[model samples]
Target chain A: MAKHDKDATFVGDSRISAKRIPNIAPSYSEFPGKSEPFWPNFLLKEWMVAAVCLVGYLLLTVSHPSPLTDKANPNDTSFVPLPDWYFLFLYQMLKYPWASGDWVVFGTIIFPGVAFTALVLAPWLDAGKDRRPKKRPVATGIMLLSLIGIFYLTWAANDEHSRLHPSNGGHSAGGATAPAAPAEKADSSFKPDAVWTAQTSCQGCHGVNMEGVAGPNLQKVGSKLDANQIADIIKNGKGGMPPGMFQGSDDDLKKLAEYMASLK
Target chain B: MLQKMYDWVDERLNITPMWRDLADHEVPEHVNPAHHFSAFVYCFGGLTFFITVIQILSGMFLTMYYVPDIINAYESVKYLQNEVAFGVIVRGMHHWGASLVIVMMFLHTLRVFFTGAYKKPRELNWVVGMLIFFVMLGLGFTGYLLPWDNTAYFATKVGLEIANSVPVIGPYAKALLTGGDIVGAQTLSRFFAIHVFFLPGALLGLLGAHFVMIRAQGISGPL
Candidate 1:
């Protein structure tokens, strides 16, 4: 193949502006001294990386299965919310004293908005042709600082979460945790009737085994509230518990209330 | 037989040149990992793409069992996890792959930035890649609410509240997202649509643009 002259003058057409086109660096325009076919060489390496990742992902899946907490309870206000690990940095940012209350938009919107915009416009923001990190002090410094900020914020978020709920175990960096098993203090001899089985939604706050979670301990609730009182609470909103949570008919609610009343 | 099949297709479709263009293209040594240890960083982008493919596949399988309504959503996910064959593995792949793809994409962005590969003519590609990154994040947000579990519920509630904290359009955005005063059946349905259809479609288009730009411009020169 004939080598093109590096400095060859190009004529511009009427439709296209010659000056508008950015000059391609020699490293990009000129053919490299050593090159290989993209097929077997580069693609082979890509496939290797992919294979390793897939295998590792499979191992992770089998070993630490994805967690499923109790079904969603819109009424459960006591449950603390934690975003996934990737969003922890942003979550942590919102907790900063300056970013809370009236100034939340700074952390919630402005900061993230500006950062994303800057990221998208990075190439134009740093328009120099110098590819070496050592030559681009400002760009390199910003990159390092941004990285440190993200890591630090994520760490702080995780630390705060663990501090708040030490018994739930520290937030898993992998974003997977074992299912939160209900406390094992329920009456084992209590047989679940049809009403109890149908009311799975109760488990969200009342606990899977009815030993209670965010809700008051219901293991022996029959010792206090009778079937009628329990039914009333289920119908009318009580402290922190939203009303009309029971989706069943009045008869079904009555049976569920009686069953709960019999728990003791 | 394979050779004959290839020749037959090449004769009719003129595929030989296309195959040659794809398979015989020269990769500059600077971008070739075999040539420089530093080029290993290039693998992050490809790995991110690989995980995205996994996510798409796993997500598709999940839809076979996933219900978008408030009533059946949790129950369906529970059924899929406990009953369906390989359900756990499939769900797990999508779960883990979501986080991994973000990590890989972030590392890829850092690599591109630090290497100064996003300069001049490559600026648009950087923008497209950034859009893809945001789409990936959007995918994560929408997918998080699908399980309808306690954590999903409260976490999404918090996320929406954060959106509601924005000025001017904040309350509107939250209303649009939640479809009402609260996160309910409509919210789940809307998020399901966005996660499975809208965002994925946008991601695919952006990815195509990103890849085409890379091919047209070729990989950036070594630092």
Candidate 2:
């Protein structure tokens, strides 16, 4: 039994025997010399680059202006809602006529879903030994194709959104055609902040339906005061309510008050 | 004075060995700054960290005045844009910084992929990187809804509607995200919670892991 045990250990050792070693490639060692030290060599250089980026970002912030739109109005169906540019590719994909009918789920789910899953599994799938680009055609090709597809889809989505919602023309980065000629202007009765104000500020105290909770029922507020008086109460705050809880322009406050007075 | 201070700390912590260990990393000397692609990866990594700092700072400032309610959300943003001092610039920094950070991340991923850096020992790093990319995308989506403008509302509506189409657990997923069948106060609150707390928390933790992974397995060499 002791002799058998000795033989077994020897066999295990023989499997990883050093006798068949291959010559190490000279390029693996000779192609690149030793690295520099960390502090001044790497960290200082990184700091210098970060400083440049900081300056550049500061300049960008000083120059570019951010966009803001009218308050949210769920009832306004004319408002063409668009997402940030990063999501434009997916948005454009969803607009494909083939995907639009009953197969909308394919565009929204299967396409993105499959792409993400494939991306995660790519390294495992393409585990070729060679590292050279020419030797690794599959990985390089996929990367190039994905890059082109994403950019093209993003451009297409932005173009479509601009064509549809030309009222937002000024903010469209490069594509400049005239605003859509027939887009109807919203009239005076269109209070964009009506439901918004009621839900956000009033709903908490006046109940979800504005029938009153902690505060008096605003259901018949129009019968009690004029739009101007109501606007004053909103701007000044009343009873337990804090002052200027409705933080908007004076004009927005007036519109909201008008919206409230008209509710009854 | 600085040397003495270092000595004082080093006596207790033995940081001299740690510093030596960090500085003694074996790298391919051919990894020069003249290699624009590699330099870009390094520069953008730094820039991404810087931009995240900017985002956090600017976002905190915005949160101070910006109301997240359905009614006051848009109005608060408008007020920030028009009424407050330098509010437009702060907001603009965050907006443009978000775009730049996303673009940089894509470029960094491309650099890594083309160079075959995700092979062998570095596979886990690539997976972590992919996680970072998706998390950043989530951050963008959740943050988009906080303003509660028509664009934000409708865009989110479209997005949630897409979520509603998944084969199984579709409705449950939609309800989970929007907090109900419709986008309202509950939806706004939930999105705010995610944008400010959950996503950021996950991002910081993941970022720490990512940096440690890179430090463990130094930058991959050129092909």
Question: What are the C-alpha RMSDs, in order, of all predicted structures?
Answer: 7.9, 12.7
lDDT of 1 at A7: 32
Docking class of 1: acceptable
- Mind sharing the TM-score for model 2? 0.72
In candidate 2, residue B119 scores what lDDT? 87
Please provide TM-scores, in order, for all candidate models, with all chains considered together.
Answer: 0.78, 0.72
Clashing pairs in 2: none
lDDT of 2 by residue, B1-223 (tens): 9978976655444566557555555445545453343455645666677788888899999898888788788888888988899988888888778877887788777777777778888888888888989999998998888878777788899888877887787788889988876899999999999999998998898888888888888888756
Model 2: residues >4 Å from true position, as ranges? A1-31, A174-264, B17-28, B34-38
lDDT, candidate 2, A1-264, per-residue tens = 445322122233343222322222222333345555454465676677778877887787676576555567786454566777888888788888866668887887888888888787778877987777778887788778887999998988877766554555523652222233332221324333444444465554455555554455666678778898898888777654656567667777777788778765
Please identify model 1 stretches exceeding 4 Å from their true place: A1-34, A178-264, B1-4
- Considering the true interface contacts (CA pairs under 8 Å between chains A and B), give the fraction that model 2 also has: 0.59
Query: Per-residue lDDT for B190 in model 2?
Result: 92
